[model samples]
Target: MTTKNLLVELFVEELPPKALKKLGDAFAGTLADQLKALGLAGADSVVTAYASPRRLAAHVTHVWLKAADKAVQQKLMPVTVGLDASGNATPALLKKLQALGADVSNPAAAVAALKRAPDGKAEALFYDSLVTGATLDTGLQKALEEAIAKLPIPKVMSYQLETDCELPGWSSVNFVRPAHGLVALHGSTVVPVKALGLTAGNSTQGHRFEAKVAKVVIKDADSYAATLQQDGAVIASFAERRAEIARQLAAAAAQVGNGVRPIEDDALLDEVTALVERPNVLVCEFEKQFLDVPQECLILTMKANQKYFPLLDATGKLTHQFLVVSNISPSDASAVIGGNERVVRPRLADAKFFFDQDRKKTLESRVEGLGKVVYHNKLGTQGERVERVRAIARAIAQQLGGEALAKAADTAARLAKTDLLTDMVGEFPELQGIMGGYYARHDGLGDEVANAIEDHYKPRFAGDDLPRNNVGLVVALADKLETLVGMFGIGNLPTGDKDPFALRRHALGVIRMLAEKDLPLDLNALLAGAVPAFGDKINDATPALAEFIYDRLAGSLREQGYSAQEVEAVLALQPQRLGDVTKRLAAVRAFAALPEAAALAAANKRISNILKKAGDVDAHVSDVLLKEQAEKDLYAALKSVVPQANAQFEAGDYTASLQTLAALRAPVDAFFDDVMVNAEELDLRLNRQGLLKSLHDAMNRVADLSRLAA
Candidate 1:
């Protein structure tokens, strides 16, 4: 078998930084899925992807070399049999075929119309689109261009020196930076094809500094990357980038001190990696006086704007030290540090001014300032949101088991967004939550209320820390509740990857807080309580918000590695409480792993089938009605086991509940073996049906055993 390699590079104008970073990963993954779905062997296809501001590429080697050969199938109707009198091809192709010196080539079309389909139809509409050849180079080049076309670049433009066309001519075009060109080489040779009028080339351009356009002839995906790296630029395979970044951070941190390290944030690290080619580490310092400004603002400025990593001191507090990685290795590292210090100095000065001014007033005194800010146009002002939050927090606190926590939560919710009005938080928007907490504490609010301000925004993104204190949970619930209810009320729901409100995140955060922390409350009623707080602002909030939260839970759980259907099944059984629902999901997952669990599922299905056959089995199997020994045995077995299953279920020992239910499997099997309950006697059949229903009720207390895949 002669195998071949194919390289596909889309050298376009410099793509947006974010788009460039995302496109490389999505491009490779989507293409691999497409190729495999086209019946190509994915394992044999080695795909190596890389991207920079200007170009995106995937090098696929030994890529199954050819597409699988298959006969194309189509359906043709019966009445169109001949061409027109002019000898032109006809709608009915027969006359054209004869004119073209052909026999009755495809009898399948006629045969299919007359017969039932074995392969849908042995027919020809316009001769079936056949696989003449796989042509890996041709297919690969086309897929790459199509993939780029499909990518959702945030800001797109067609650089046509003068002409206005979305697909710019290569002669004079520009991307965000500039579109030089793309290269697709087929095993040490330029892949010869022109699908989108782009010809494959053996050339590639490296980074702008020391790297230049060079002829790179590679034999495989691995070699292509090594060739690129040798030329310049890191070929960003996900695993490769991750490992390299980790090594750089570790090495940099070790150089500073054993106790010092980069603060944790996965997303910032990813963006930082994409923004640089070779990472050269540097540790810089800020004046300790700036630390007096809220650490929230200080750290946000460092990480968010500068991509500077803050380092921890030995005492586990934000310190004056920071570590930053620059793209280029500068001769005067001191000058680089000085330039950064220059950039942040003014920002830190502004932060200190905001902090001083904010501290002059109590958090309560600043509460009125929220009225000037807008939360969402339809949802009302920030002041209105605060009112809603306060109302919701009070109810949630009550649901969460107390008056003290409720009062603190309500106070925190009312004052949480106060920092949005603060000049310091305005300058550093990322510091909103933490700043509010800081100011509240400075203003002499109790620790519970002050802490709740910061804690409510816990787990800002997925896997972020949740609030440990009950006071925080209450306020968090209120904040999330108000957004969800208000957004859902106004019908500005997320659709087709557009979630302007991040209602989904709020729901996930709410679920994580409620379930992960095992908060004592019903989520459904809490959502209800939030609606009234929103007052006439919400219409039909109950069911809609419930469904919205459910969707959020399903997505969040699926992202955490649980199957969506599994979450749905559990939620369908009980949507009253998120904490219990999550627990139930965990229970079902654990139950699924047991050896006897599959049998129990199969047995439950069997019971369902029997019950379905003999309807209305709600009553007792009076000995008079039990005409069969099998029916009597099932009744006796269920009576003994149902009690214990209920007990375990009440105690929430779902694993034990599943085990106890499985114990009935033997009796159920034996009963099925001996029973012929569907006899001529109607009463006996009804009696057997009732017995099966009893068993179902007992087991379903833990899960819908009927839905479990045996």
Candidate 2:
């Protein structure tokens, strides 16, 4: 029952910078989980993960040396079959006891030891035994193997390691990297474990160049990180290293005092953190002439290509100086700073050259080049896609605005894909729409068109901003719609998580624009209108695409804190104008909170069922046919309440309309209680059905009230 803290480390070649954090987290998490599953660790055990360029390690607290023994009861067989009427064990009972390693020398003694328990209608013999627990050595071996197997390795490398036996032969081993060392310790004792052809030890290599010693000697589970940092010249924890880098970057920027700061990109920071063991921030600079190119080009090149953090001024403009996270901390540091600056100059010059050469032809001239660029094998060239987008954009602009906006949107859409042909975009594909905006302005097109051309790809990801102007919004909607309709039309719908064309993102973009901007366009009409632009290339997929958009909207609404029931009630109506969905949902929520809401919702559900069963019944009733007092009262209530609700609905006050209709709950309950909708008389049944149908129609104008029924 002894417990001790445990430490495990795997030393290998540099891990993929992008996947290091995931690999580390998975390694430590799986190891701890497997230990707990084997009962070698408590539920409240603490696990800490450490990762660097060359190592993945974990430290777990309160791990047991051996799991506690547990009692186990196992069912043998039915008592009738295990024992004879003479109260003696049969051959089957003796065989079962033998297989369970029970005392079968004396049959009566074995039979007396068995407990009879009722299983269903029959009695069954049960065996009880004390199961031995797993020791730390065996449990940790299983845990270590499971952790390695479950790591989220981006790629596996195969290598050969010499056999430890007498035979001098090699064996092939596959892992994320060629692992060289492994250390597993329970407290201060080295656990004799083996993995990847390496035996567990207390020593591991640290920083490639700056380590004070050849190997870091981890003393104990509690002192592993401190010992590594002090002796190995490496920060073992990924988060601690990243924080240190940020702190140094901030301090270095303060020294270059112009209110300058490094560009904030978490992905770049994480990747950089994964690439180094010990981080030393240094400020380096390139020529100011390189700033002639768009700052985006410089920033992207610095972050994506060089893994550098480009500094920006207070106004968010790129500064000439950038910060580099070096692994080694040299005293002079001038060589590292100069070498980085020299290395980045050529990259900046190439970007400048592409930017300069791209401006000579103008975006209009490059439009013809897009014809030769294949967009999709089935969808033809980028030229064809541009034409479809232009048509859709013009149509959308006409609906949202008039001729002027239509003209602007058409121009923006036409030039939007021209950047795909530019040399700058060819080198850096992420700058496709961005380069188009710059070239649009250079081509003497007004800022409106240039802005639209750029903003047309707005909301490229979740939570991204929408277009800044009406023209941009129109073109963005058109572009996303064209992709969505064309893809869905061709049976390229997103299945599971395999959306190669990002159809889900496109659908959500369309929904966000429609709902967030409160555009006065119908969702169904937009999907339908976008279809003709594809002509015969795509089938009509309006219904399927609308469902996809609504599904995305429902998910988004739920994530925003709307309950599933509230969303279901409102979306059940399939409200065409998505802008009004929120309003409808608000009204449904308010209606659901009423004291009479439960009864009304239930009655509405009941009415729906009766009307469905009765088939087509008109919402017409004759006063003479209302022979019952409850029926007459319900008719009077409807006549009094229907007009007020209708007026409120027409005025766009959905909440008010639903509340006004709440007045019918009392009369509705009485009618359902006192009268049968399907009476024996034909006229009475039809008239009662009609009365219920009328009430159903009024109650569900804003949302399907029946869906709100408990």
Best by TM-score: 2
Give the distance in Å from residue 422's predicted Cα in candidate 1 to where it truly belongs.
Answer: 1.5
User: Stretches of candidate 1 above 4 Å error?
Assistant: 1-14, 25-45, 58-148, 162-177, 181-246, 314-316, 376-378, 547-572, 575-578, 581-640, 661-696
Decoy 1 TM-score against native: 0.77
lDDT, residue 62, model 1: 60
Summarize candidate 1's per-residue lDDT along 573-596 as a digit string, tens digits: 665656677667777888777776
Query: In candidate 2, what residue range of length 10 has the lowest lDDT sum?
Result: 533-542
Question: Each model's C-alpha lDDT?
Answer: 0.70, 0.92
Per-residue error for 687 in candidate 2, Å, reads 1.5
Give the per-residue lDDT of model 2 (tens digit) for 308-330: 99999999999999999999999
Give candidate 2 regions above 4 Å deviation. none
